[model samples]
Target: MILLGIVLAGAAVCVAVGIIADNTAPATLTVFGQHVPGVSSEAQVFVAGVIVAIFFVMGLAISSLALGRSMRVRQELRDLREEREESLTALELERQQLQRELARARGNQRPTTADIPVAGHRKRDQDPVSPFFDQSA
Candidate 1:
Protein backbone atom coordinates (compact mmCIF):
# COMPACT_ATOMS: atom_id res chain seq x y z
CA MET A 1 0.00 0.00 0.00
CA ILE A 2 2.79 2.39 0.82
CA LEU A 3 4.47 1.55 -2.47
CA LEU A 4 1.28 2.39 -4.32
CA GLY A 5 1.09 5.74 -2.55
CA ILE A 6 4.71 6.55 -3.44
CA VAL A 7 4.19 5.64 -7.12
CA LEU A 8 1.04 7.74 -7.32
CA ALA A 9 2.83 10.69 -5.76
CA GLY A 10 5.71 10.31 -8.22
CA ALA A 11 3.28 10.30 -11.16
CA ALA A 12 1.54 13.40 -9.84
CA VAL A 13 4.86 15.25 -9.50
CA CYS A 14 5.87 14.23 -13.01
CA VAL A 15 2.61 15.55 -14.47
CA ALA A 16 2.84 18.80 -12.52
CA VAL A 17 6.40 19.41 -13.65
CA GLY A 18 5.49 18.61 -17.27
CA ILE A 19 2.59 21.08 -17.13
CA ILE A 20 4.76 23.82 -15.65
CA ALA A 21 7.51 23.24 -18.20
CA ASP A 22 5.02 23.44 -21.07
CA ASN A 23 3.79 26.86 -19.82
CA THR A 24 7.33 28.31 -19.54
CA ALA A 25 9.31 29.97 -22.35
CA PRO A 26 11.89 28.03 -24.33
CA ALA A 27 15.45 28.47 -23.06
CA THR A 28 18.70 27.96 -24.95
CA LEU A 29 20.82 25.16 -23.48
CA THR A 30 24.56 24.86 -24.25
CA VAL A 31 26.65 21.75 -23.57
CA PHE A 32 30.42 22.21 -23.63
CA GLY A 33 29.80 25.66 -25.27
CA GLN A 34 27.97 23.82 -28.08
CA HIS A 35 24.31 24.69 -28.75
CA VAL A 36 21.97 21.63 -28.48
CA PRO A 37 18.67 22.00 -30.32
CA GLY A 38 15.49 20.08 -31.20
CA VAL A 39 14.99 18.94 -27.55
CA SER A 40 12.43 20.70 -25.38
CA SER A 41 12.93 21.18 -21.61
CA GLU A 42 9.55 19.55 -20.94
CA ALA A 43 10.61 16.37 -22.73
CA GLN A 44 13.87 16.18 -20.74
CA VAL A 45 12.08 16.73 -17.45
CA PHE A 46 9.46 14.09 -18.33
CA VAL A 47 12.15 11.56 -19.24
CA ALA A 48 14.03 12.22 -15.98
CA GLY A 49 10.81 11.70 -14.02
CA VAL A 50 10.20 8.37 -15.76
CA ILE A 51 13.76 7.22 -14.97
CA VAL A 52 13.24 8.15 -11.30
CA ALA A 53 9.98 6.22 -11.13
CA ILE A 54 11.57 3.14 -12.70
CA PHE A 55 14.38 3.20 -10.10
CA PHE A 56 11.87 3.52 -7.27
CA VAL A 57 9.84 0.57 -8.49
CA MET A 58 12.98 -1.53 -8.88
CA GLY A 59 14.02 -0.76 -5.31
CA LEU A 60 10.61 -1.77 -4.01
CA ALA A 61 10.73 -5.03 -5.92
CA ILE A 62 14.16 -5.96 -4.55
CA SER A 63 13.03 -5.23 -1.01
CA SER A 64 9.93 -7.39 -1.49
CA LEU A 65 12.02 -10.33 -2.75
CA ALA A 66 14.39 -10.08 0.22
CA LEU A 67 11.46 -9.97 2.64
CA GLY A 68 9.92 -13.09 1.10
CA ARG A 69 13.20 -15.02 1.29
CA SER A 70 13.69 -14.17 4.95
CA MET A 71 10.15 -15.25 5.79
CA ARG A 72 10.70 -18.61 4.10
CA VAL A 73 13.91 -19.18 5.98
CA ARG A 74 12.25 -18.36 9.26
CA GLN A 75 9.41 -20.80 8.60
CA GLU A 76 11.85 -23.58 7.75
CA LEU A 77 13.74 -23.00 11.00
CA ARG A 78 10.52 -23.16 12.98
CA ASP A 79 9.55 -26.48 11.37
CA LEU A 80 12.99 -27.94 12.14
CA ARG A 81 12.72 -26.90 15.76
CA GLU A 82 9.30 -28.52 16.08
CA GLU A 83 10.57 -31.77 14.56
CA ARG A 84 13.54 -31.87 16.94
CA GLU A 85 11.26 -31.34 19.92
CA GLU A 86 8.92 -34.16 18.83
CA SER A 87 11.80 -36.58 18.32
CA LEU A 88 13.27 -35.72 21.70
CA THR A 89 9.94 -36.38 23.38
CA ALA A 90 9.64 -39.73 21.65
CA LEU A 91 13.17 -40.75 22.66
CA GLU A 92 12.49 -39.84 26.28
CA LEU A 93 9.36 -42.00 26.28
CA GLU A 94 11.26 -44.93 24.74
CA ARG A 95 13.99 -44.60 27.37
CA GLN A 96 11.44 -44.69 30.22
CA GLN A 97 9.82 -47.83 28.78
CA LEU A 98 13.17 -49.57 28.47
CA GLN A 99 14.06 -48.73 32.08
CA ARG A 100 10.75 -50.20 33.28
CA GLU A 101 11.35 -53.38 31.28
CA LEU A 102 14.84 -53.78 32.72
CA ALA A 103 13.53 -53.35 36.26
CA ARG A 104 10.83 -56.02 35.72
CA ALA A 105 13.36 -58.45 34.22
CA ARG A 106 15.65 -58.02 37.22
CA GLY A 107 12.81 -58.81 39.69
CA ASN A 108 9.75 -57.12 41.30
CA GLN A 109 11.82 -55.22 43.84
CA ARG A 110 12.20 -51.63 42.73
CA PRO A 111 14.18 -49.22 44.91
CA THR A 112 11.97 -46.48 46.31
CA THR A 113 14.85 -44.07 46.57
CA ALA A 114 18.15 -43.45 44.76
CA ASP A 115 21.53 -44.49 46.27
CA ILE A 116 21.95 -40.94 47.51
CA PRO A 117 20.99 -40.57 51.21
CA VAL A 118 17.87 -38.63 52.24
CA ALA A 119 17.57 -36.35 55.28
CA GLY A 120 16.90 -38.07 58.69
CA HIS A 121 17.63 -41.52 57.24
CA ARG A 122 19.96 -44.05 58.95
CA LYS A 123 22.77 -45.65 56.92
CA ARG A 124 23.46 -49.39 57.46
CA ASP A 125 26.22 -51.67 56.06
CA GLN A 126 24.20 -54.93 56.43
CA ASP A 127 23.76 -56.79 53.13
CA PRO A 128 20.20 -57.49 51.97
CA VAL A 129 21.27 -60.95 50.65
CA SER A 130 24.03 -63.23 52.06
CA PRO A 131 27.08 -63.62 49.74
CA PHE A 132 27.08 -67.48 50.18
CA PHE A 133 23.40 -67.83 49.09
CA ASP A 134 22.71 -68.54 45.39
CA GLN A 135 20.36 -70.75 43.34
CA SER A 136 23.22 -73.18 42.44
CA ALA A 137 24.33 -73.43 46.10
Candidate 2:
Protein backbone atom coordinates (compact mmCIF):
# COMPACT_ATOMS: atom_id res chain seq x y z
CA MET A 1 0.00 0.00 0.00
CA ILE A 2 2.82 2.38 0.84
CA LEU A 3 4.51 1.44 -2.38
CA LEU A 4 1.32 2.20 -4.26
CA GLY A 5 1.06 5.60 -2.63
CA ILE A 6 4.69 6.45 -3.41
CA VAL A 7 4.24 5.43 -7.01
CA LEU A 8 1.10 7.54 -7.36
CA ALA A 9 2.78 10.60 -5.80
CA GLY A 10 5.87 10.17 -7.99
CA ALA A 11 3.70 9.93 -11.14
CA ALA A 12 1.85 13.10 -10.19
CA VAL A 13 5.10 15.01 -9.67
CA CYS A 14 6.50 13.74 -12.96
CA VAL A 15 3.35 14.75 -14.77
CA ALA A 16 3.58 18.27 -13.32
CA VAL A 17 7.24 18.52 -14.26
CA GLY A 18 6.48 17.28 -17.80
CA ILE A 19 3.78 19.88 -18.23
CA ILE A 20 6.08 22.61 -16.93
CA ALA A 21 8.97 21.57 -19.19
CA ASP A 22 6.84 21.14 -22.34
CA ASN A 23 7.21 17.33 -22.60
CA THR A 24 11.01 17.46 -22.76
CA ALA A 25 13.16 14.29 -22.75
CA PRO A 26 14.34 12.94 -19.34
CA ALA A 27 17.46 14.56 -17.76
CA THR A 28 19.86 13.61 -14.96
CA LEU A 29 19.14 14.99 -11.46
CA THR A 30 22.24 15.82 -9.35
CA VAL A 31 21.73 16.41 -5.64
CA PHE A 32 24.48 16.33 -2.93
CA GLY A 33 27.02 15.32 -5.64
CA GLN A 34 24.96 12.19 -6.47
CA HIS A 35 23.80 11.70 -10.08
CA VAL A 36 20.77 9.55 -11.08
CA PRO A 37 19.31 9.36 -14.53
CA GLY A 38 17.00 12.28 -15.41
CA VAL A 39 14.97 9.82 -17.48
CA SER A 40 12.83 7.40 -15.42
CA SER A 41 13.66 9.41 -12.29
CA GLU A 42 10.25 9.09 -10.66
CA ALA A 43 10.08 5.28 -10.89
CA GLN A 44 13.66 4.81 -9.64
CA VAL A 45 13.34 7.05 -6.57
CA PHE A 46 9.88 5.74 -5.62
CA VAL A 47 10.90 2.03 -5.80
CA ALA A 48 14.14 2.56 -3.85
CA GLY A 49 12.38 4.51 -1.07
CA VAL A 50 9.60 1.96 -0.81
CA ILE A 51 12.04 -0.97 -0.60
CA VAL A 52 14.00 0.71 2.20
CA ALA A 53 10.87 1.42 4.21
CA ILE A 54 9.62 -2.15 3.82
CA PHE A 55 12.92 -3.63 5.00
CA PHE A 56 12.99 -1.34 8.02
CA VAL A 57 9.50 -2.36 9.05
CA MET A 58 10.38 -6.04 8.64
CA GLY A 59 13.44 -5.67 10.86
CA LEU A 60 11.37 -4.07 13.62
CA ALA A 61 8.78 -6.87 13.47
CA ILE A 62 11.40 -9.64 13.70
CA SER A 63 13.15 -7.97 16.63
CA SER A 64 9.86 -7.58 18.49
CA LEU A 65 8.99 -11.23 18.00
CA ALA A 66 12.39 -12.36 19.31
CA LEU A 67 12.11 -10.13 22.39
CA GLY A 68 8.65 -11.40 23.22
CA ARG A 69 9.81 -15.02 23.09
CA SER A 70 12.79 -14.27 25.33
CA MET A 71 10.61 -12.55 27.92
CA ARG A 72 8.20 -15.47 27.99
CA VAL A 73 11.02 -17.96 28.56
CA ARG A 74 12.37 -15.90 31.44
CA GLN A 75 8.95 -15.84 33.09
CA GLU A 76 8.63 -19.59 32.80
CA LEU A 77 12.04 -20.11 34.37
CA ARG A 78 11.04 -17.87 37.29
CA ASP A 79 7.87 -19.86 37.88
CA LEU A 80 9.75 -23.15 37.85
CA ARG A 81 12.26 -21.82 40.35
CA GLU A 82 9.47 -20.81 42.72
CA GLU A 83 7.93 -24.24 42.52
CA ARG A 84 11.25 -25.92 43.28
CA GLU A 85 11.78 -23.71 46.31
CA GLU A 86 8.32 -24.55 47.62
CA SER A 87 9.01 -28.27 47.26
CA LEU A 88 12.25 -27.95 49.19
CA THR A 89 10.47 -26.05 51.95
CA ALA A 90 7.87 -28.79 52.22
CA LEU A 91 10.57 -31.44 52.49
CA GLU A 92 12.31 -29.50 55.27
CA LEU A 93 9.07 -29.14 57.20
CA GLU A 94 8.41 -32.87 56.94
CA ARG A 95 11.92 -33.62 58.16
CA GLN A 96 11.41 -31.42 61.20
CA GLN A 97 8.13 -33.13 62.04
CA LEU A 98 9.77 -36.57 61.89
CA GLN A 99 12.57 -35.39 64.14
CA ARG A 100 10.07 -34.20 66.74
CA GLU A 101 8.29 -37.56 66.70
CA LEU A 102 11.59 -39.38 67.16
CA ALA A 103 12.47 -37.17 70.11
CA ARG A 104 9.12 -37.90 71.76
CA ALA A 105 9.66 -41.65 71.36
CA ARG A 106 13.12 -41.45 72.95
CA GLY A 107 11.81 -39.36 75.90
CA ASN A 108 9.07 -41.91 76.64
CA GLN A 109 11.52 -44.84 76.81
CA ARG A 110 12.45 -45.72 80.49
CA PRO A 111 14.51 -48.58 82.09
CA THR A 112 12.73 -51.23 84.23
CA THR A 113 14.29 -52.81 87.43
CA ALA A 114 12.94 -56.11 88.89
CA ASP A 115 14.58 -58.86 91.07
CA ILE A 116 14.82 -62.29 89.49
CA PRO A 117 12.16 -64.84 90.48
CA VAL A 118 13.69 -67.75 92.63
CA ALA A 119 12.19 -71.19 92.10
CA GLY A 120 12.64 -72.88 95.60
CA HIS A 121 12.32 -69.93 97.99
CA ARG A 122 8.63 -68.90 97.64
CA LYS A 123 6.48 -71.82 96.53
CA ARG A 124 2.74 -71.07 96.26
CA ASP A 125 1.66 -74.21 98.30
CA GLN A 126 3.84 -73.41 101.33
CA ASP A 127 2.01 -70.19 102.17
CA PRO A 128 -1.37 -69.25 100.78
CA VAL A 129 -2.04 -66.25 103.03
CA SER A 130 -0.17 -62.97 102.84
CA PRO A 131 3.37 -64.27 103.37
CA PHE A 132 4.91 -61.18 104.99
CA PHE A 133 4.71 -62.74 108.54
CA ASP A 134 5.10 -66.53 107.72
CA GLN A 135 8.79 -67.01 108.60
CA SER A 136 8.10 -70.12 110.76
CA ALA A 137 6.59 -72.20 107.88
The Cα local distance difference test for each model comes to 0.65, 0.60
Off by over 4 Å in 1: 1-39, 114-122, 126-137
C-alpha positional error of residue 23 in candidate 2 after TM-score superposition, expressed in Å: 21
TM-score of each: 0.55, 0.47
Question: What's the CA error at residue 50 for candidate 2, in Å?
Answer: 1.6
Q: How many backbone clashes does candidate 1 have?
A: 0
Residue-by-residue lDDT tens digits, candidate 1, 33-59: 444465467677456457656766665
RMSD of each: 9.8, 18.8
Off by over 4 Å in 2: 1-33, 36-39, 105-137
Kindly list the per-residue Cα lDDT of model 2 for residues 12-115, writing each as its tens digit: 45543543345333343333344444435666655644654565555555666666777999999999999999999999999999888887889955344324
- The superposed Cα distance between candidate 2 and the true structure at residue 107, in angstroms, equals 5.3
What is the Cα-based lDDT of residue 93 in candidate 1? 100
User: What's model 2's TM-score?
Assistant: 0.47
